[model samples]
Target chain A: MTNKLAKLIFYLGTLISLVLFLALTFDTHRQIQTLTHADQLSEQVVAGKRVWHKYNCNDCHTILGFGSYYGPDMTKVYWRRGSEGIKAVIRSPEKFTTWRKMPRLPLTDKELEDLVAFLQWTSEIDTQGWPPQDQKLRGAPGRAVTLGVSPGAVLFQEKGCFACHRLYGTGGQQGPELTHVGSRLSYETIEKVLTDPRSTNPQATMPPPMVSHEERDRLAAFLAGMK
Target chain B: MLLAYSSQRVAYPYFLVALLLFLLQVVVGTWLALSYAVTMPQWLVDILPFSTTRAIHTNLLVLWLLLGFMGTTYFMIPEETEREIFSPLLAYLQLTLLVGTGVTAIVGFLLGWTKGKPLLEIPFPLDYLVVAGALIFLFNVGMTVIQAKQWTLIQGSLFGGLVFLAVMYLFNLPFYANLSIDWYYWWWVIHLWVEGAWELVAAALTAWILIKITNVPRELVEKWLYVELGLFLFTGIAGTGHHYYWLGAPKYWLWVGGFFSALEPLPILLMVLDAWHYIRNRRAGLNGRLIFTLAVGMSILHFVGAGFWGFAHTLPQINYYTHGSQVTVAHGHLAFFGAYVLLNIMSFYYAMPRLEGLAEFDERRGTLAFWWMSITMMLMTLAFSVAGVLQTYVERVMGLGYMTAQAQMRFWFAILVVLGLSLLGGVILTVVDLLTLRPALAGAKKA
Candidate 1:
């Protein structure tokens, strides 16, 4: 091709693409408020975003699939770990130690609340089904029931119990392996330990189990049946 | 044997600093890989947490690459414009400001000061210094090109790319209340800079090097440069959509991103063909075998890593499963190494001998370093890919928790750590060869 033709192609192609990109960007801006629930972007959520930056959280954790891969993606974190779970971990990351530990940051109560609020806002944004839900976890309880897995097994996965405690050959090493917990503790003792770990051993670092009495019973039975 | 212009010597320090920073980047990166494979000591973790170390690693990559680009510009512009640099003193000042800012940023990150965005984590105040440095660089180069008033297509493209790069950084400086809005513009800086601006820069540099090495007619090389970069901007600007698909953008982005990004590989393919065509039709015997090999190697891996590996997961359907997983990491390592890193190293190999006024130099050690670095990087990419695939299957597909999935991928991470150490050895070899290789004597045969 001649220089003039090549230059024309260069200018025209770049111009066309730039124009299209800007048009899409403009339309995206128009629809963004509704898509992201801009009305719900509270002061606390903004403060939480500041907290996120102040602590350099994105350096480890990804939000909206952006940032480093050192920590887990925090887009759906509000759904994965509830507000209380998030607050607990932030308040004392040492207590939630696992294979991949989150470093402890000295966040105040207000920062903790704000960060959770920001995460909540992020969870609510429509990601267009990005980070596709795990096929097994989609209707896990029902699938477990069909597969003859106990409700307690489903709760174990849902409550993220396996994050700290291992069963069989899988899971974290932070807590003792529970492959044969049924052989050691009766259902009553297991339930007591789940309800109040500090009662069983005052040195127990496990926080009080965040479950209803029925969930506690189901988990105890599941562990009791593991022998 | 001497450089065509004395002002070209200004690039020597830029290249030296870039390589030094490159070594530091690899060190931090290897440490990160080790941390992933095995738990680091608690005291070490308390002092240099993964977050701090990771920030340092990525920021170092950016800093080194920028230095490389600036050096390449300084070296090439004098030849292209047929004049001295507009202001060599200003160039040195820019370098000092940038390096100072980088050192301070690393120390600040350790002291708990950051803006917290990945890659853009060079705290708020230091960012201004970066912007100022960029402005100074632009002014100096802009004046050089403007005063020459004899613009070749290569010089024009190079200037355009530099200006575009500087302009894009403005996007990262703002804060948005909405996270979606935040990321939308964030991609403007991150995605657009890589796919759009940096591609332009790489294209010009590659074309300039090919013209110099092959003794090809300027018209012929510049023609291909125009066509290739034209196609690049055509596909790349909209290819920004691929990043938009999952970041709370409109659903239409899924289609836009998928369609445009699929075409993104075409220009890169064209680039490879363009280089091959010029290399095959060269008029003279090949000189600087190591530099030629690196240039050719850059083209091949650029196609494989950025073009092929990028296309591997650019589709929304595949990306949905792989986004934020090890799959992205796999693509990232290969793409950056193949595209930008090799380009910089190639420039160093091409320019260093001439900058030192050597007619020829022993190249065996350089060649050995080349193979070592390239092969190890390819292997590391493979290790990360295997781990990514397994992680996706276990964590995303099987619904395992993050730690459980990570447990399964430890074997691959172990492989990565070993490969990273090997890569470090290669880097050390390169540094040694660059520093210690002596000039060949007159009447001696080139290696």
Candidate 2:
């Protein structure tokens, strides 16, 4: 082939590629803008992403499994820590100095709010059901509980058992550690404790289970299998 | 070093600086590999962590390769244009500014002053210095061509590529408020550099080397050069879509990124074919030496690593499994070493003999170094590939925990540590050979 024709072919290929790039660039921008409309994230959430970038939190932590492995994954921290725990941990990470510490950030309360909102938004993205739920099993060992499959497991944390009740004997002194509650409480007794909590203990600070009968049964089954 | 022309001496500083940076990268890189293999102490890790190690390694590679390209262009430009350098003083000043700024940035990273983006880690102040240096280089080269009575395809493409490189850096200066937008431009810089501009530079450099060292006619090499450049432009520009697949971008990127990136391997394949032909039908004198051998080795090795291995994961389906896995690391190691590192080394090897009138090049050390470095790197790539595949399967597929998945990858990391040390040994040998070689009384034979 002649040199001129080769140059022409080169230009042709580049032009085609350029045309694709221009079209894709526009399409991608439009798609992302559209996502924001249907997406649950508010303006505050995106500003929270900016706060995450400002500190370059990714230097130590990962979101969606793309950053350093030093810090815990923040994707499900909203679910893991809840709104209160996330605020407490980042407000003073030095407080949780027992295992795998995170450094404290000098964020204002507003910044903290934004960062949490951003993390919450990230968790909502359809990660095609990533993190495989085993990551959420971080609290208890050998439970093999898939939270999505067993809504009761989600209820366990959402009800704030993690704040006071330890699954493997590693929680607060406010409540009895429930690691082997299966051995300790039968389904009838466990249900009675939730429905008529004073029957199990007169000094019980636990609220009665307010969920539907089926949900109560599921949570009972989840707590019963502890043994 | 006996000088033939003023422009020829310019490559020495670049090749030597690249040698130093290469040595640094290997040392830090090996330390990083060992850290992964064993449990590093927290206190020590507190001072120098894995993230810092990676940041330093990638940044140094970027710096030295940039310097190498600038230096190689200086050497090739004058020869290709058949003219002297526009201003020797400007050339030296450009090198000093770039190297000084680059070294400062690396040192600053040690002190924890960085922007924290991998590969785009040059801090705010140093970024400006880099821009100035690139502009100076462009001005000097642009002037050299302006004054020349003649110019060729190689010179034009190289200048065009350098201009693109400098212009691309401009996008990186803006701080996008949106994380998605930040990711969008970040890929523009990284993707465009490796797949876009560097392709042009590599093709031109390959053409220049083939014309000088082999019996290939200038016109034939230039023609193939255009074809390669054409492929690079097509696959490279559109290839940025591959990065958008997971960055929370629109859904159409899955098709755009995957299809174009799959085609990215074609240019490298063309390069391999061209080199094979050059080696097979070349003049006997140019067939066996260190410089010619590197030219051939790097060309084919680049295709194998960057082309073949890159295509392996460019598909969205596969990338979903391997996005941040060690499989990505595997491709990173092989692709960067083969495409940029070896490309610079090839420029050094072929340029010195012709320009400095050196004889008796380090054939033995070069060959031994080739075997050690190339073989060890390939092994490391294989190791990372295995580790990555396992990590993906266990972590993503089986729904195993991260620690459990990492535990399985430990065995591969151990293999990588051993292979990394071996690669370092070969690198040291190459550095020593380049630094101290005995030049024979007579000059190298012409092709």
Candidate 3:
């Protein structure tokens, strides 16, 4: 292409990208509005919202693609997992996978019911076919995944965790000397503690479980075998 | 061994004070990171105390960086301007006022005396003092440049940075709002000053240090200077889109923010390549190899650590998920500390001993400080970035609440602890080296 034509094409491309990005952002905004309106939501769903914020749910999960993206997009979670499967997982996340685990949070029955309603409500929304590809099970079924090695390592690096905890005698000093925790704790125990460590230890001050089962398992095993 | 020269040795006391403050700031930042590693407080859900810690960490970073920058600028402007300072007395007074006022403001913030803006959290009254200090600095550097009439690119660059900073700061102050347009103007200063004007200042200092140490051609340095400035202006202004992504602002910001931020790395890339090229050409001619190496290394970091990683989150789409998460922290950690503060430290290594007539000072100590600082920060940046991305996954994508996400993120915090300790080791070594080298270099010949 001639320089002028190439320049024109580049500008056109830039303009198109800009337009598309704005459209996506607007869609996100719309989703947020839909998520926030309480009149249409059930009391259980409202109570679940309270639980989400009280625990700072945005710390781990993205709803409508706007919060966190650690475990799964919980927006359509109920539909994906199905209500019965989700309730079962909620009852005992450890039973779902031997390798992957989530903290069994101590939610009251009402809270659990509300949380289920919230998840169900979330799953019913029009997500414009998100999940572009299935991240869970990595587009395959029944893979007992631990942490993927280097990506997990890269995740460790990217998260600034290396600033504090040492794996195999490397990193920072402000937290529990995690030089040997992997061998100390099973993936189940690790998942249990990570989800809500206050239940495990009242004085434990570690932040709430902020990662997904896969990431947790990946990081857990990485640290677990650190001898 | 005293050679006749106009410059006097910068008092060791200034560095001593700067070091102590830096140590304190690092401790706070470490604590803040720990807070992130765990959960937010349940009871004191008030933004007051946590906000104070945030302000303190951010403000101290700005102050110390400024102190170091100003000290370097004071030494550099005179040399580049070819004149003595217009008023050394005023410079001292300005320093005292800034340190005093800054400490008071932070104290006030902790005591619930803030306007409650995220970055512009300092109460309205104290801002006047900051402006006063900035103006005095501008006058000192500005008059020196004018008097010399031999305005080099470095001087032009610093002057440009200072001028823009003043204008932006003034524009950010909202005199009327109860909340004072807290978040809006916060970006004016935070987004504009740090990413916008600071790049100009950092590039200017980096190029000047390279020129002085390597005695590289001024023409080449000046050309790089313009390219840096152009890139800074283009990306810096447009980069405001990143901040607007979540602030209930215009949707068009995503496009503007992403595209501009993506381009933000260009100047840094150019800077890194040019520095390498300059060093490769001048290595045989350069005498003080350590300073040359530090200056060049600083440039490369400006690109890879700051520029490349910054581009990773420049898009509003990415930022939509990443905003206020560990990912943002990752970018901020690298860009602010890696590119900007590291570059300032490079300036100090290049100019401090020379301006102080301690050219033969223990290059070993300086070299150690250089490596310790670089390695510690590099590791820290890598950790923060990794932690941030992981944190994003746990917190944003995973459907875990903030507290829950933080619990999982403790793994990353473990890494931060390691980096913190490394930084601690580095800081201690820096202090020791600075102390030992001072007395040792006391008797060295002035060039």
Best by lDDT: 1
Ordered list by TM-score, greatest first: 1, 2, 3
Task: Name the 10 consecutive residues with the lowest summed lDDT in model 2 chain B.
Answer: B438-447
**Best-matching candidate per TM-score:** 1
Worst 10 residues of 3 chain B by lDDT: B175-184
Task: Give the RMSD in angstroms, all C-alphas superposed, for model 1.
Answer: 4.2
Output per-candidate TM-scores for chain A, rounded to 2 decimals.
0.69, 0.55, 0.41
Q: List where candidate 3 sits over 4 angstroms from the true fold.
A: A1-227, B1-16, B37-49, B175-182, B283-286, B438-447
Q: Which stretches of candidate 2 lie over 4 Å from their true place?
A: A36-51, A54-56, A59-114, A125-227, B1-3, B354-356, B440-447
Error of 2 at B136 (Å): 1.0
lDDT of 3 by residue, B1-447 (tens): 332224323323345556667777888777666554544443332343244566677778877777877777776776677668777777777788888888898788666566544455566678889999989878877877788888776787788887987888886566422111234455677777877677777778778777766667887777666755666666666566666554434445566776777777876777888788877777345445566667666777667666877778767556655655566566666677667767666666655555455645667667777788777777887777776776567655763333455566667777787687778777677656655555234444332
DockQ-wise, the better of 1 and 2 is: 1
- Compared with the true structure, the alpha-carbon lDDT of candidate 2 equals 0.75
Clashing pairs in 1: none
Clashes of 2: 0
Where is the poorest 10-residue window by lDDT in model 1 chain B? B438-447
The DockQ scores of all candidates, in the order shown, are 0.52, 0.27, 0.03
